[model samples]
Target chain A: EAAVTQSPRNKVAVTGGKVTLSCNQTNNHNNMYWYRQDTGHGLRLIHYSYGAGSTEKGDIPDGYKASRPSQENFSLILELATPSQTSVYFCASGDVGGRAEQFFGPGTRLTVL
Target chain B: EQQVQQSPASLVLQEAENAELQCSFSIFTNQVQWFYQRPGGRLVSLLYNPSGTKQSGRLTSTTVIKERRSSLHISSSQITDSGTYLCAMGRNSNNRIFFGDGTQLVVKP
Candidate 1:
């Protein structure tokens, strides 16, 4: 099975602080994604990357930026965190095609106070 | 407008009972996937049935691309099955997946 891991599984930050969540996958998948999960919204995509150094905005990309520095590492950056940004973030890695099954990391829960 | 919709926002079931979940898409899609998330845990892919029927263990997923709908049936529910079930559809144009609000399931012992 594919292995995906996220750092700082639980986080607490003051408002206006910078928060960065990191993800690493060992499956060597070409596509990686970042998403935030809320109560009613389910999972909203923030950003995704096709490969290293390529980033594309997803349905909900505002207030979040993504970086794919390498094939195995993808990161989600919150430059200026706010109270409303407190939510659970997930990282996923998938193969090249649309029908490919995605493998997700454990998830990172961020609390902005 | 929501691209994907899931029925029964929440459901409570007794142990040994069967649970059925439904998912419908508003747009044309041939890629459908089912996921399960334990309470405060990671999202785990259960089935990737874009079309036809597939089964794994106690979970069975059937997808009808032409009808733009899919269903997941869980037989003999257990207390460990309590969590959220999410359905997602993939867009071929942009390679983006849209998720439904999910069906929260609670199983009673």
Candidate 2:
């Protein structure tokens, strides 16, 4: 199985506080993505990395940053968290091409208070 | 604008009943993937149907490239099958992924 794991399955952060969510995958894939899921809106892409040392903004990348320091690790950063940022974040990894299906992580539940 | 759209935002069914989920792309797409999301959990890839028909377990997916649409048929659904079904479309030759809002399913015993 392609395993994608996330850290701090649950988190609570103060407004304007810094928050970081980490993900690790053993799939050895080249593409990784960060998505936030909210009610009514469903899941929206926040950021994605094509490979190490590269990151691209998704449809909704405001107030979010991504880091791909290595092929196995990807992180989503929030420099100034707000109540509106409270939601579940998911990380996914896939093969080099879009034809391959992405394997998603367990997801991190973030609550910005 | 939502590039990928799914019909019947929610569904409720009884055990052993069948369910059909639909997905359509706003524009042309070369790759289509279906996923299952448990309540407050991760997504599991159900079928990666680009075109034609594919089956896995009690699930069957069909995609028609010319029509730019896909459907998932669930036969004899169980309570464990209750979850949200998501559809993702990838632009032709490009890897950009677009997601649908998903169809929530609830199965009652």
Candidate 3:
């Protein structure tokens, strides 16, 4: 089983402020992902990484950046947060190849004021 | 671009009643999965039936790849089963997965 934990379970940020949501997984999976969940929008992938030092843009990557400093860490950064960016964010990891199972984190709720 | 759509945006059920959830995709995919999520809680994978029928406990998932659709059937629903059901499709081996908005379920005892 994958153990995906995220830091700062809750957050509140002002407009134009910078926010960074950190995620850590102990599953040792090769892939990691960041997503935002909103009403009627479900989960939209923002960024993903294959391994350390690798980041790829997902479906909705605007106004967001991702970092994979190590196999156990993946982070989502909002350089200049806005009210429109407020939503619950999730981090996941897994092997999408054979026997695919993508494990999800508890999620981080970010509120941009 | 790929899109996953779940029908009956919301549902209400009584104890011991049966429930069915549907998921349809706009693109062809061999990767299909079902998940359960409690209000403000983490997601729990229910089934990973990509192209066939699979069952786990009282839950059954069937996928028709050619139709790009899948269905999840839960027998004898319980209050503990009240939550949102999500459907997702794996885009690639790198874990590129897309999810539907989800169908919120409320079970009354």
**Each candidate: how many clashes?**
0, 0, 0
Which ten residues in a row are the worst by lDDT in model 2 chain B?
Answer: B89-98
The per-residue C-alpha lDDT of model 1 at residue A53 equals 98
Q: Please, what's the RMSD in Å of model 3?
A: 1.7
TM-score of structure candidate 2: 0.96
Candidate that beats the other on TM-score, 2 or 3, i.e. the better one: 2
Alpha-carbon DockQ of candidate 3: 0.56
Error of 3 at A94 (Å): 1.7
Put down candidate 1 lDDT per residue, A1-113, tens digits, no spaces: 67999999999999999999999999999899998888767788899999999999988889998999999999999999999999999999987656656889999999999
Candidate 3 wrongly placed segments (more than 4 Å): A98-100
Candidate 3 per-residue lDDT over residues A11-70, each given as its tens digit: 999999999999999978989999888876778889999899999999889999999999
C-alpha lDDT (0 to 100) for residue B4 of candidate 2: 87
| CAPRI-style class, candidate 3 | medium
A80, model 3: CA deviation in Å?
Answer: 1.7
Mind giving the per-residue lDDT tens digits that candidate 2 earns over A21-107?
999999888889999999888888899988999999998999999999999999999999999999999999987645656889999
lDDT (Cα) of model 1: 0.91
Report the interface RMSD that candidate 3 achieves against the true structure, in angstroms. Answer: 1.9
TM-scores vs. true structure, each candidate: 0.96, 0.96, 0.93
Point out the higher-scoring one by lDDT: 1 or 3.
1
Q: What is the TM-score of chain B alone in each candidate?
A: 0.97, 0.96, 0.94
| Superposed model 1: Cα runs more than 4 Å off | none
